[model samples]
Target chain A: MKTILIVIFFLYSQVQSVEPDEILADQELENVARIIGKELRCLVCQNEDIENSNADIARDLRILVRNMLSEGKTKDEIISYIHSRYGDFVLFNPPVRFDTSLLWVLPVIFLMLLCYTFFRKKH
Target chain B: MKYFFLLIIMSSFGFMFYKGLKIDPSIVPSNLIDEETPNFQLKKVENYPLFDSKDLLKKEIKIVNFFATWCGPCKIEHPQLMELSSSFRIYGIAKKDNPQNITKWLKSYGNPFDKIGLDNDGISSIEWGVYGLPETFLINKDNKILYKHIGPIMKNDLEKINAFLK
Candidate 1:
């Protein structure tokens, strides 16, 4: 009974916030929209992506993504259009730019320093 | 030498954490600053004059405000807008709100907008990059977006708004 309940809970959690009305008619386009939505951050929720967020702005963004896809816009074009308006904060995977380069560089530098210290101590 | 490397790493992380603490995560900086205002055409609310992108190009400083009848902050900021209207041309976009509620709300609180637009579908708000209600944008004479205020314009903000206008 516990295993069954766990399975049900997992199934329920998989249900996305995308409303039926927001779904695209074309299956291929809908898949593409889902992929894009998962990458775009919901500005209102901050942490949750537009695909999973229940915020009104997330819904609006999901619809906008679908509309753009149906209008023949490529994923990059759609993402960039929203990015241009909302800026780097709205992108979950932020582009490596002058301002953002530190986020990518700091982790590798920390790792190298840790390895150097570990090996130096052993030697 | 080992301690020197450790100190550098620890201080760098400490510096980043200190800088992060100073920033309020809720305040997302406006990306549209210094950029041309996005193009949009919206219907007039009630009998007010229509507003569009072209109107922003006029050689005068203006304000674009995204508001909704259902939003609490929008009500709080309404008086500031009213005070601003005496000197500035303020354009309002009613986001996802019906005309009836807007008319009634404006009547009770007073309509401060020089021209009000009905953004019933909310596309205009998206174009303007409005994530929340009561977002105000200051537009310069060159039609560039000068500054953006994310929430209700309190009395203190009036001074800042005036400074931007100047």
Candidate 2:
């Protein structure tokens, strides 16, 4: 019974915010949508990706992604389209622009500083 | 030297906190700023004629406010909106709201909108990239989006909006 429950929970985790009607007929396209959706953050929910968010805007974005896929748009094109409209806030991993470069580089610099401090010889 | 380094780290955090306190998180910067406004067509809430984005191009500058009857922040900004309407051409977009509720809300709160559009499906709001209710967009004469306000309009916000108009 425990094994069965575990299997059921695993299966349930696959069910995301995408509604039955929103699924693309093409399995290949649907897979692409899932991959892209995981990368896109839900602006309203902030922390949750649009793929997992139940927010109305998330649903709209999901539909939009599918529509763009069916229209033969590449993943990059679809992502860029939404990014242009919503800005860097919609992207979970925002591009390393002038203003956002610090966000991406700070952790690496911090780690390097820590390593240098730890490795430095005692005077 | 270690104590001096610690002091620098601690002061940096303190400075960050001080700056964070000065900024309002609710006011998210819009990507549409200085970009052309997205085109949309919405039916008027009343017996008025259809309103389109093209109509706004004729004006030197205008305000496109996204609101709803169900939104609390929208109510807080109502009187301020009414005050703004007297001086500026403010077009309101009602998101996913019942027409009757909007009509009633307008009656009670006092209608401040010069032109009101009923966005029953919320597609237009999505096109405008609205994060939440009570978002306002300032559009320039060239159809470019000038600025965006994300929350209820406060007294300081009124001054800022007025400054932009000038």
Candidate 3:
């Protein structure tokens, strides 16, 4: 029983493993797609807080971005397209409105509070 | 200044093209790791009379390598695989590759597999988790996979495979 518990715990920790078929995805093409996608000033990436490292999986997301671009999809449509496939994780920068308003506003409000406190004390 | 900018532009584009050529398109995704080893039962290429991949239940650590006669990496890695097979039971997946070519490859490069299976249509390779001409899978004797190498075998790979076999 203890052995089984330990084994289960070990398997649980490998959270980033890929499926065998998933290994068949190209790494180079994916990398090209990701760098272009995340850096093209998605406004969404910055708003949503996406980074620029271009990890392999992020590269996959990049390819999807290019495919959408080739399809002649607009920027807004592209943002939504990624959102639908990967959920909010697709956006490097999140938008300030709608279901994600708090993600955007809370930080701004906190900064304002900090500024107000500093200025008030100075006064 | 204009010439320097033009040089930079030309070099950048040239670098991309050179990188593309260096990058073999056969490389698939990293997603195939940690999944089940593709199931197969191909006849032996050396001794076509023999059979193999049936010991999916054993505790022996195994590596199934996909190769073709035309693939450069396959030729490069063949010698290393031959050396490793003395300690580890390596299986071969001939990716839509013919028996004559495989036999010739073995004759020149050196044969090391415990058994070679035919992935004739290139479709079986998709199941066994092959992305290119010379991908390798390190499968535990239990038929479960432990790791995968996407490109040619190198010294680092040999050490890693040895560790896994251990």
Better of 1 and 3 by lDDT: 1
**What value does the lDDT take at residue B32 in candidate 3?**
41
Question: Candidate 3, which segments miss by more than 4 Å at Cα?
Answer: A1-123, B1-32, B41-46, B49-53
List pairs with backbone clashes in candidate 1: none
In candidate 2 chain B, where is summed lDDT lowest over 10 consecutive residues? B43-52
Ranking by TM-score: 1, 2, 3
Model 3 DockQ vs. reference: 0.02
* DockQ of each candidate relative to the true complex: 0.75, 0.50, 0.02
Going through the candidates in order, what is chain B's TM-score? 0.96, 0.83, 0.74
Residues A23-87 of candidate 2: C-alpha lDDT, one tens digit per residue: 99999999999999998988877688999999988888888898889999999999998898888
As a TM-score, model 2 comes out at 0.85
What fraction of the reference structure's interface contacts does model 2 contain? Answer: 0.45
**Model 3, residue B46: C-alpha shift (Å):** 6.3
Q: lDDT of each structure?
A: 0.91, 0.84, 0.61
Instruction: State the lDDT of candidate 3 residue by residue for B21-51, as single tens digits.
Output: 8865334443445555545556556564333
